[model samples]
Target: MDIWKLGAIIWLFKSHVEGRAGIGKFLTSFVDNERKPTTVVFHGICWNNSVKLHVMKELSKAGIRSSQSMSKRTSLIDHTVLLLADLNCTGTDELIINASCIAQATQRELHRLPYRWLVLSDAPRSGRSSLWDPFLVDSELVLATVDGAGYTMTEVYKPSPTSPAILTPRGTFQHVLTDTRPHRELFRRRRDLMGVPLTITNTIQESNSSIYHLLQEDSLELEHDLISKNSYTLAKVAFLTLNATPVATFTNSFGYLQNGQWTGVIKELLEYNADIGTNVGMSQSRLKQVMFLDPLDNGRARFIFRQPALSVTANIFSLPFSPDVWIATGLSSFVAGVAYYLSTRLIKTRAEKGTVRDAYLLTMSALSQQGCEVQPRHVSARIVLWVVFTSMMALYAAYGANIVVLLQAPSTSVNSLATLAKSKLALGAADVNYNHFLFRASSDPVRNDIAKRVNSDKGPKAFYGLTEGVEKIRKGLFAFHSVVEPVYRQIDRTFQEKEKCDLMELDYIGYAAFHVPGSKKSPYLELLRVTFKRLREVGIKSAVNFRFEARRPSCKESIAMFSSVGITEMRPVLIFMAYGVALSVAVTAAELLVFHANRYRLRQRRVAVQLGRI
Candidate 1:
């Protein structure tokens, strides 16, 4: 039978326990015909909270009740002895049965609630056994008090070959936090301990900003002031020891039923190989895997493309309207010319024989936005001409104003996703981006077309890296799809203001993030939940991001060094200028042809008159 077990014994004293100490130790015994003691102080710590509940159940069945000390003043006076393990112990308790012992917490202060104590037959040194830390008296001290008075220590445990050694439950025992400084307790459980070492994974080592590099310092050292780098970095701080591996990837479909099987970090967690999953995108499908805690960050996948540079020496007047509008105006001028010939040729009009040619020139001049040279003498022709001239005057004035505006402000390269998709430029996306999958699966025809374009042979070749994609975009006639943060960082580090000014990014895809545990049964998952919540309340997480951010791109005008009146910005104006010049040349050619024909007719009439007289 266990030495600490109750045995058939009796307590002679039924009197009240009234003394100087109120709760002292040694020779306090109450026994039955069992193997264990009638009074026992069950050991406890934060990590052992769940196990402690079970021990309480076992104690109750043994016909004994244990003492509980929640706060510092929770009345250990109810029992005869307390297993007081003090974090700041400088006290002593002697084992009267055999040896005198010095407790690590000999000198008690205001209270001994936080202090953890151990009593033994004798103090054991460090090397002989991994179980015992020998600064305290490791005695199997049991107690039974009378009334609200001093209690007695019922049993003492001494180590020997014949006697079984009393053991502290390692699995249930929580670690005593060395730092007693108070905090918001948002990320920490009310009573929980670092029960065991855990395995965790992170992104592969390619950059310093990756989760792997951020958590390196914490993984190497155990006791230091916690400095968080990111959400996952802060999560790592909760564990005193972690076996971190490089396997965390941006997985959105980890636990989802994929082709009748499951994959990703969630699988490793389920199998108990990894304790926590980092930087996993949150989704309803993934929630079925383990569990998702707080988000690491929020971000979007969008298009980043080169912006067209500003133009110079533009035919600013013509830019107010489109090419189609200009074409319609020219066709209207031809119709007006035909109308004048019909309205005047049969009416015996007051105009001269060259009136047909003059009318055509006048119509052309009106459409070109110039003053007409011919004046009409007939009322019907005059009305048609004046109406055309008035409309032309309003158009001319508007074009002049718009030209001034164009000269002051430049145009953009691509204004929207629709423009980018319709453009002949090569489009690409980083092979690792999960949004590509979402885009390809889009129901919208425009988005579907864009996805097909990117995956096509004329688009970006498959599996190109972000750096390569960025290089292609910088060369112009190219666009890339990626998350904003990483691409923003690269541009911040690489591009000048002039180069980055025209670059435009469009937001199209956003995803929710989550941190997952190895299994639903993981005890530490609760600690993670609490810690994650605390981190947010403390303002460690902001709307933009959780950590370091890059400066946005900016620039002054005339930074391109050399540019021109680019066709992209001055298309309408240039087309109008060309149309006006062509019309003027044609009008001049018509006048010369008419003048020569009129001279030939007069010469022929004179020769006929001379022949008749002979």
Candidate 2:
């Protein structure tokens, strides 16, 4: 009878060992097949070595790597960690104490929370225990615990950024000792918040320079800048798709990193005070602090200015006709000049005594439509003169017509960043938060030089107010670095239709658009991504973008609207006139010198002759 009892006890112990092993097997399968983590970290007290070792051994068997160190901090955003805790290690009846110990051990190492958790204990699952209270609000986690002969799992997630972690049962893994079926549905679709409340923050300074302002609940808009407006609207659409309530908060700035810390919207996200950030421009530095979703605006920040005058861009005298046409004109003039010279020599007329130089001068006078004292009376010479006159008259008429058109046409030379940097146009940027920072931070040589020029000219006040910048752009020769939509709106209101015809832009900040940002390892990130993708796929996003951002206003007025020519437009002509005057002065000086020399020589000759006669 004693042998029979001993055998029954051994059988019971074997069943318990198999049950524990089966739990380890299931966890190994989940980690290896489902999560497929590159590196898995294990955190457990010394007393929980058996449970951790069993799982680690199984993971190793499945060709997975595991780490035992818990002191080093790792980004939970990219890496997955599995934590196991023995709830009975402390000999405490209270579950909160055990949970607190687990939270404290990991809270320092993991800035956020672990990817998965397993709690082992002989105690029954209780309703009064606050096991998940120590973690950050809405941690979006999956945890499992021993439930009788089987195991039960629950997920902790937030419906919104401000909401507390909601614990929901994810069903149980029964028949652990014999079950071979894979259940991939446990963690899938867990991101669907099922109508939770989230908080989204934006930079809505109370000052007049704010990117956006509150018009109503969940309604934000910008008067001049539409980038923030469009993003805000898209974020709202995402929240609706998730059936989550969005709470809006406003701050003074988008956020700036100062003294190794962040300020404004970025600070709120880092501290987990907000779920998502609106109108956040993506940058390498910002990416380290938070995760950004799909780009809301792909529009680049650029230097917008009027196209410069053609004369300012190129020599107006040479631009009216092509090189070939100019060559033909020169050849024709030479032939006419030479013919007139030969005609005078072959058929000498009493009225016309044309030397080589005189014939060339006469040809130029005909081209210029000027009168000459000498006339060739011979019929052949006269016929040659008429042909030259008629051809030059037609060429001069075409040249004049082209010059008039070119005077009004815009210059296309300053269309790219390299050209813009080399151009004489004065550079400035809108006084928004990111311009100065991005400009100075750029590594490109051209951008660096542009930033330097702006700072050298304007110093600390290098940036201009939107209206002030737009006003300078309208005044001409000023390239204001700003997003297009806001500048377009300002241009639409103040600039004339004729002025719009010359409006041009050069790419400065090359971002496709500003993106909506969320906290690092945000649970709503995927939902935000899918929501945006859906909006784009269905063309809703395009509609919202079109409504807020303004395109370049069309040129309604005739481009030939007459205005008095400024020095900038007539620069080539002025330069030509200055050269002509300088040459004329030089020739007059040479002639005077020659006249003085001739007078001196003649006087000496006269003196010699008088002396000889005496």
Candidate 3:
């Protein structure tokens, strides 16, 4: 038999001979009678049938569920305690390989490893060359080791990469095989690290360029991107509260799944190179690989632009009156024109010899409050003209008053995503990784149409930098989709106070927050969460955000400033005048052609008569 097997046999014999409950008394203390018993999973090559059977019987007596193998579908609640049956047979190298395999299986099944360990051998000591580095590095766990005679208990955790796992002795049962000594709490959920060093990874894009570097400056103001600066502040504050010395590492990306492998900060975490990844998004794919802490900021990307002029959404000339009012006005004008023509025929005066065209011209002149050469000779004709002029004066005044307000008003038509997609505004997006993904990958038809408009020419020109995108927003009739905080910072710098009043934003990606991510099964998860929550409650998070995200500029100037009429507002009047000029030119050309045709026909008749006489 192996040394572990021999030791186990001796241990059992001693316990039975001493009339002690052996492993049962220690195991029962971990269970609460009111709740379900804690589960114990045992797996190793060292377990023979007799040894396994004996341990199983003891576990059953303690009211704990003991399993030799773990199912892939096991719940995380079932991962209470993991027992490595015989670790003494394998040296440090063998122990590492075996533990790595077990960790992989546990992570695959529960997405995290167990925090409590029960080892049958005392091979894993707290040393620099310990085999427990891979699993216990930067993590906290309850460790209990048993030899033939007795067992020793300790809480094992590592604070930094340079330091070895610190083992705090809890209890020891050496002389007696087992006793009714109460089991003290193993994992007490510690928050303060007492100024331990930690590796924190983050990304810093420099000079609005794609290249990224580690943050060299300690000051937040020196950072170009507001998001990067804000994240740095929050991370610094939270870690400092926990009394940890953070060693910062900068990567080019937050992390992305590239070629079936994670790159950047995420890779650092998976390889145990980083303890915390700052300024990370809790995207679905990322959550599968890393455990995200509580959200720091509820960030959102949106379509932001200036509100378009009313003329862009509808015909400004027609907006002066409703359809019913316009119809009534047109009918009244036509009736007045016809009435004047009929009155002229009835009166039969010198100025009353009016054609249908003359009657309509006189009607238009009166409606415009202009004088015409034609005069009414009789009472009936005079009465008809007076009535038509009086009614038109009131209608004209109302129309002019409404036109003044319509010219200055902003259009609210493109308020929703559906309307925005149907609007005539030129669309563009910030040239970033996630924006490209969202625009192209969305299955909604409205989102697809918006994507098509942004990629209208099917080229790269539609994507712009933050500076360029904000500039386009200021120029009017252009909408840009981008992250809110960074874009607002540019707006605050470049946009005028009056222009800020017209600025509008529509949500693109819903308001999901970004969080600080750490490696899965990190021992510091709860402590970090508590610190962040406390920071947010104390308004530190808000204070940090204020430095990065520019608040919407005040609209004080909007109340007193006058909007000047632009070419867009004057287009309808220009088109009307052009039509009138074209009509007059066509009439002149027609009259000249008619006069020449008549003269030619008259000359031809005279020549025919002269030839006949000859």
Candidate 4:
């Protein structure tokens, strides 16, 4: 047998023998026998009932004995076991306090003789705040609470109350307070006895008494709303099979499913004004059901919802002029201006001999051969006219062309203002044009279209990218194009680029009285109307501001004039003047060199011819 068991048996024998033998004789017998010290188990008694008698019988059979006696000091038991009885006088809290004191004493004398302590309770209450302290103080002490008769014994121990609580070998303390409230006076006495800070938490019902009505009313209101909103089909079906009563029905019906569906159902019930008791039960059932349900597949759902769409007619209408066209037009104007200025100056200075006309004609022919048309009568006039005409035409053409070019530019081609504002489309990576499109297309019809597109995909699995509306575009993954410019500069730039896109001024149509009015002083509102007027004043003949070909009517008269200049004195005069200027220059250089050579050659030739030295 185990040493402890043997010790217990010896202790039982001694106790029984001592009861029959007197104390002095028992001591003398023990010394004469030279027996080792025996272990004893101690138990607290309450009314010494039949249950206690039965327990005593069981201990006696196990070679363990129990005793209780009033003494000045604590009793000496090699091994002490404290058993508690279910009695009304000594409440659960008081019983726990006394057990705590006994356990503390056992701990102090741990080194003296190996000893074991056991605490057994029948029908012990739970949820007492300080019930866990004794178990926490010692690990070797075994504590148990068993259900006896119609009552359950709930054991609990907490190492620290301020921190997260853990269950000890004993059950939870919170179970203790379910039936009875701890007496405040009893807690005070225990605090005095144990020299520890111990407190009992009052029931939640006792606190918040005044505004409880408001909470109830709110709960009722929420419940109604939830019932109206919840999918009632499932709940109704589940409620039918177990329809013994609403509570029993739901509990029995939903007890087997996964927690998620249960949680959802409980949540729905709560929203519909169900009582707290029902809500709690449903919630617990739902939680259990959820634990059994398959883990959610968020990754797969995201993949399915995030597929990209190809857009067909994005911002084709709002296309800007290409950048290359702007560069070409500007360069051509500058080059033409320089050429006309130099050619006309040369022709004018030599025109006094009437050869100027011929030179002018020749220049016109040369230009005509090169596919350019001359329109003025005089060479200088033609030069000035061509310069002014070309510059003006290039400026206007470039403006219109630039607008088109910007609209068609690679940066703008992937998406346009209307497309960006109207459709769910993404901009290119690192595109600066997105900002311009956003600002300019604010009133475009496409804005509504984009909004609708985004709304359709609204969910956890929605794909958000630049191809979608600019505002709804996702960040980090999606790229957007933006332009940085002074606020005023964007206005000018937009106007310059608008013509190429063939955009017309948008009229500010007043909506019905019920519709909100747009700002009358809006800069965008001004931009549309103001540009129309400006273009008209600048000789652009458009029925509406953006009517194509109206402002670009071919000038037949000018072409005819150029052709006439080629046939008139202009061409012949240009040839003669070229010859005369070449002759004059050649003669001048020849005359100077001939004069020097004549003087030297005449002297040498005369001497040679006369002397016949050769």
The candidate that achieves the highest TM-score relative to the unseen native structure = 2
Alpha-carbon local distance difference test for all models: 0.49, 0.69, 0.68, 0.32
Candidate number that wins on lDDT, 3 or 4:
3
lDDT of 1: 0.49
In candidate 3, the residue pairs with backbone N, CA or C atoms under 3 Å apart (3 or more residues apart, or in different chains) clash, namely: none
Model 2 quality (TM-score): 0.78
Compute the lDDT of residue 600 as modeled in candidate 2.
100
lDDT of 3 at 473: 94
Better of 2 and 3 by lDDT: 2
How good is model 3 by TM-score?
0.71
Q: Would you estimate the TM-scores of all the predictions? A: 0.49, 0.78, 0.71, 0.20
Per-residue lDDT tens digits for candidate 1, residues 1-614, read: 65334332212121111221112222121222223333345333232344345545555655655554422232343223335331111232222212222232232211122222333222322223322222121123322222223221222222322323333211111111122224423122122232344455443323334444454533321111112134345555544322222223332233434586656556766666665765556566667767666664454457887753334323445567899978877787788888876666657844534366877888878877777656766777778888888878887787777765565453474677676677666777777535444456467776777777776646554445767777776766677886555676667666665566567776544353334444553434545565556656776555324344333566564443433445665666567779979998998999889988998988999999999999
lDDT by residue (178-235, candidate 4, tens digit) is 2232431211111111222211111121113312322232322211112111112112
lDDT of 2 by residue, 283-374 (tens): 78888898887876555678899988887888877888999998988898999999988888886666767798878887998888887766
User: Candidate 2 has which clashing residue pairs, if any?
Assistant: 160-197, 297-513, 298-512, 298-513, 299-512
Better of 3 and 4 by TM-score: 3
- At residue 440, give the lDDT of candidate 3: 66
lDDT of 3 by residue, 1-614 (tens): 69999999999876653433354455544343214445666655354556566666877876678777654534455446554444554452454334544433543222224334544445446555454554433243445576445677665655544557666665555653332324332223345576776667766543543123224433334324445556666777787887888767767566878799998778988886776775666677888888787666545568998889998788899988889998888898899999999988876766458778878888989878898888777688789999999999998899889988887778889899898988888899988665655676367888878887776645655888888889999999999997676777788788888888877888766546667788764556656767788888999988767655666666768666668887878888888889989999999999999999999999999999999999
Q: By summed lDDT, which 10 consecutive residues of candidate 2 come out lowest?
A: 92-101
Can you rank all candidates by lDDT, best first? 2, 3, 1, 4
